[model samples]
Target: MNMKWYEVAKIRMKELDINQEKLAEHLDMTKGAISHWLNARREPSLDDIAKIMKYLGFSEFVVNHDGTISTAGGNENVSNLIPYKPGKEYPVLSSVQAGCWAEAIEAYTLDEISEWLESDAHIQGDAFWLKVEGDSMTAPTGQSVPEGNYVLFDTAKEAMNGSLVIAKLTDSNEATFKKLIIDAGQKYLKGLNPAWPMVPVNGNCKIIGVAVEAKMRFL
Candidate 1:
């Protein structure tokens, strides 16, 4: 069962022994805004929800895809709140095929997926998954993405400067993951590993997607 944000807010207030006015005052928010949130007239942003949950002494809060609130910390049982809808599934592409991921994904049928992965959260936009294939982006400084980890890219999001992105050269048949760097009026795909050569994003280069999140699977 999904609980609305307002219901969760009321329950948390009761559990914390605080009144609505006190909560509104403590959060430095207007009473009407708080009331609006409580009455489901206005939805709070994720940041606002996090602030409210933290103020209420919750350490973990998940904004579920189905517009529900799930809390965990102390004595709260989060298992009941998880929707467990298998989340959003994405296509896992190989290094060679990842270069043309934008085009290749359209040709794939859902039934043909044996090597696919699922998102644990509701990610906005068309997303795709890729397994780290090489150590080109792996560095010894312990800040690099390790090989075999799964990276989720949102094609709908524009690649911003300093964002990790999957890019491919127009003439190449493979895709590579690196930090997108723009310095001195030049764009370059910079890898974490010092051993790997930096590749310039000329007119022949195409960005696939901005890497949003990565997951590690032990099984």
Candidate 2:
């Protein structure tokens, strides 16, 4: 009989002398959550499973081409072992479309979308992709999101201090991308480039979503 993904992970952890607490620490998750997953009390998301496999120094849990996850070993037939579904495909919206996303999303169907991109991250609620437009987010050092890249935004995520977000100004119809900063209870939209000026967030500013991932394409 083929071992389950969690069972394999448990064996690997024992060999590596890593306990549940240590694995949780390495994965930046809670020990209780890790315990639940390993004990079969709860199922982990596909992304979490991937993270666990990565930290365990193997990639036995693999995503098949048909969007099913399976456990693989030498000379073993691939089979769907995980009960969870695959990651979702989100529409790639233009800046203008993203600016009016709330209204636009309701008006169009998934088939109407020109382009859609898939992500491996476990997302809650609705999500979308927006291409980077300008150099305002480009910085000389530290974390930088350069122009001509794609950013995946999660609408359900709360906008926290120092989070990259897509914002809309009530005074204007277009959406803008910037880093969110909260200073002394006051919020501000700041660009990564030092030369760019920071825009104060007030009644007119609305945070559309928090950026979850950034990807670059070379063709």
- Highest lDDT, which number? 2
lDDT, candidate 2, equals 0.72
**Total clashes in model 1, counting residue pairs 3 or more apart in sequence or in different chains:** 0
Taking the tens digit of each residue's C-alpha lDDT, what string does model 2 give over 122-190?
A: 466689998887788889999888888889998988899999998886776657888899999889888
TM-score of each: 0.58, 0.61
Per-residue lDDT value at 63 in model 1: 70
* Predicted model with the maximum TM-score: 2
Flag regions of model 2 displaced more than 4 Å.
Answer: 1-51, 54-86, 96-107
| Candidate 1 clashing pairs, residues 3+ apart or interchain | none
lDDT scores of the candidates, listed in order: 0.68, 0.72
Clashes of each: 0, 0
* Model 1: worst 10 consecutive residues (lDDT sum): 96-105
